[model samples]
Target: MKPEAKNETQEMHRVEMTIGTILRWGVIVAAAIMIVGLLFYLVDGSLGVASNYHVQNFHQLLQGLIAGKPYAIMMVGIFALILTPVLRVVVSIYSFYREHDRLYVIITSLVLLILLTSFVLGIEFQL
Candidate 1:
């Protein structure tokens, strides 16, 4: 292949590697956070305390998180787990844009839009 082609291929590979790293680390970190929360619950024996699931808004969620609530921490980990793939979609959009692959950029952008819309609906409808 031409030098330019080789360089482009290398760049794409690097981008793929970055996406893989993001997913791997996202899951690992989220899992670790969840495990810590679980251990805290086990040691503290706070299962009787009701989980604050009706987190009316982001501010409430942050307040719960700041208060060191186990369920809130676990939910944050789960949210991170759920968002990892959406992050991949975002990175994919950037990679495609870098490659000047307009079609894929548009496709990935649409995927991101759908993901955001669903998240919004989930928060609004308490799904």
Candidate 2:
């Protein structure tokens, strides 16, 4: 194979590996956070508190986190879990753009736009 083609292949492989590592670490970190939150809840004797707790927005979430609220910590973990794939999509868009693959870049961009729109609409309609 031409050296240029080989280098491109290696670059693509590296990108794929980086994406995989991001996904793996994202899940691991999220799970660890959730476990810590569960442990806090269990030890703090707040078993039923989460049932009544609702975080209204990022501000509230941050406040609760600062106050050492277990549910807030768990919510953060959940958010991280949800964002993992979205991050992957973002990375894929960058990877395709780097490779000059316009078709995939456009497709992934649309996917990201749809994801963001859904998030906006969901937040707007949320009670």
Candidate number achieving the greatest lDDT relative to the actual structure: 2
**Displacement of the residue 95 alpha carbon in candidate 1, Å:** 0.4
Instruction: Kindly provide the TM-score of model 2 when superposed on the true structure, using C-alpha atoms.
Output: 0.93
Least accurate stretch of 10 residues (summed lDDT) in model 2?
Answer: 47-56
Global lDDT of each model?
Answer: 0.85, 0.90
Compare the candidates by TM-score and give the number of the best one: 2
After superposition on all C-alphas, the RMSD of every candidate to the true structure, in Å, is 1.8, 1.5
In candidate 2 the C-alpha lDDT for residue 11 amounts to 96
> Residue by residue across 1-127, what tens digits does model 1's lDDT show?
9999999989989999999999999999899889977876787778324655466677876876787777767777888899899889999999999999999999999999999999899888984
lDDT of 2 by residue, 1-127 (tens): 9999999999999999999999999999999999988998988878334576666678988988888888888999999999999999999999999999999999999999999999888777765
